[model samples]
Target: MLSTTNPFTLKNIADYQYFSKEKIETAIQKSSDAFEKWSEISVSERLNFIKSLINTLTKNKQLLAETAVAEMGKPLKQALAELHKCKLLCEFYLQNSDFFLTGRKINTDGCESYTKYEPLGVVLGIMPWNFPYWQVFRFVIPTIIAGNTVLLKHSSNVAGCSILLEKLFTEAGFPENVYQNLLIPGSDVKKVIENKTVKAISLTGSEKAGASAASAAANQIKKAVLELGGSNALIVLNDADLEKTIPEAVIARFQNTGQSCIAAKRFLVQRGVYDTFMEGFTAQVAALKSGDPMNENTYIGPMARVDLAEEVEKQVNDSVAMGAKIVLGGKRNNAFYEPTILTNVTPDMPVFSQEVFGPAVPVIPFDTFEEAVALSNQSDFGLGVSIFTSDIEAIKEKVHRFQEGAVFINALVKSDPALPFGGIKRSGYGRELSMEGIHEFVNVKTVYIK
Candidate 1:
């Protein structure tokens, strides 16, 4: 038996295995070897196989959802909902892959021109634990349908779920390395990237990690697509429907306990309606329930880990000391953060620029329309933003004016496999869903034949 020293200073909530250098190499080699056979299959065939994978997920929904909740402390109900969303992404891609990946014919000048989508062989996908299954499924189904095999480097905290993912894919008839999980520490991720077999990389993580991966990918001249953190603002203008906007705003902020990448992190209310909006928002927040994820009554679960909870608590304390006010729920018990709401956040506070990535939200009021747009564009991260208004003119103006990847109006912004999802600035680049995702790791070939 080989004795191993675990590299992580803290044991992950799930005790995920840290793969050795040799193991990563082996997985990469397997994926490379498997790609030939997998890619040889027709796109329609691959889509059918992925549809079967969704069916498997449906049959095993409870077991998988329970595992995710056990590993990361996500609400059981929400976790079940996550499973359903995963299925949606699966079927969405299955139904639409043919449409997105179909050869495109264009009338360029007087010549006949058609563009074909080709697979990039092998793709290395790095995922986070917050939405363990959804994130991977969101990336995997699309890539596989595009004729690419996947090598998942899921967050160590969700290692067990990682195992289930591979099993599900294999049982669904994925070839040897068509979709494989590498139970590895991220410290050695560069080695996997450096491999000749890894044609490209995809990531959904913090800004720091995305930068590191981008550098690694650039060094090797391989393609990389990233969806980093976000401090997405939920802007509510004066003329907006106050009743509808108020409840949606609170749910937008605290959904996933506000840990979501597209979660409304900054509340930029036009000062004209700020006072009235805050009154309703704060009351709904105060009435929130916080406790065990398994308890159906609990509206807020623990923050995934004790250290993460502490980090969130520190951000709240530091910001409040610097003059921010907590209107509701700022306490922490172990890994559980109270569903917190703060006001008077300045741009300088770490909480404002950096994604809180927890169960807390910061509300900043702006006086004018220009100021609202300016404040919304005031972050390094620009993944998604929500706009609440009945004004068609304002919506048109902001969509043209806002500096984020996706803009949501009258709805919470989220990733749908049918739509392209990614970010800009520090939020990283490249689109993740739709035909955009399929082509991200593929050689978009333009054949010019006389």
Candidate 2:
């Protein structure tokens, strides 16, 4: 059995019967069978089903939001926002998928030559607990519209949300076997990946999990898209408007209780503005209220699980021991961890070097832009980075120096349906959302005519 314990209440909320190997096999076979038919449907027809998905999401937004809150401790408001984002994504693909998937004519020696986008078969998605609905839908929507079927093996901690997602797809009028949730443990993921019916894989989770999934997919010679961990940095220059940047930085780090992969984990501020940014940032973080995820007023919630809270605590304690000062909120209770801020943090500290995966932001002072860029690029995970400065020319010159998948200027780094999202180095590879995402599982075939 797979059971989900509410991090906020520290109580068992739901239990799902695990999928046997035979059932997993059946899902794979059915998805593979469905893909043959699904891939043949016109893009306009697929858009109709996607439209139904958007309507279903809008209709059941509250229910979906509450389920995410109970299962994974995301604030109800943020949960609802995630569902809305998913809806927007559905609409995004509906408006642009045809243009994205349209064949392009190329100049060639042949009489007529063009490149066509054709769907691969079934794709296996290994999703995580954080942003459960968004992560799954972000990958599933594009894959399906590109004419591929999907089998989800969601995190064990969010089993109820996973089951709810399967139901959502069905209610959206998606054909049978088009989107199936596999209620299986992580150990069984390899078996599903090794299944010949699955043509590709996409994962959103930890660095270790991403490495393992990539290795498994590589062994099968299957295409894989991995959106892994991030220790993203928010660089604040001396000229940056603290009034505007500080609040955005706080949200970037502490929203969703700082459980996002793209959340700003490291704050690299210029020495001249270090103290000013620290005062405002710390005060903003201190004012964040941690309470019941279902509470409408709560801005911060429990860390997703007891073990996850403990991990964040260990990182903070270890960093403090390494001469880092806890500016505010370093306490932990059960699964609830306080929104923490640390100062005098050096590169050697775990809080500076590792992905904290919680509401803990470390403020590291830097003397120069070179130092700030170096500090931001020091992490092994390079998912995204944010730079705050008024000089557009200076930003253009220094933006490429920060090695990350996405860079936000005077704003928080975020994923958008219009932009391709993914990272380089240890942050994992391939893109999600936009045209790049839909093409990830499609075969770009070159056709030559005599």
Best by the lDDT measure: 2
The TM-scores, one per candidate, come to 0.94, 0.99
Per residue, candidate 2 scores C-alpha lDDT tens digits across 124-216 of: 999999999999989999899999999999999989888889999999898999999999999999888998889999999988888898899
Q: How accurate is candidate 2 locally (lDDT)?
A: 0.91
**Per-prediction CA RMSD (Å):** 3.0, 0.8
User: lDDT per prediction?
Assistant: 0.83, 0.91
Q: What is the lDDT of residue 146 in candidate 2?
A: 91
Clashing pairs in 2: none
lDDT of 2 at 71: 86
Off by over 4 Å in 1: 1-17, 106-113
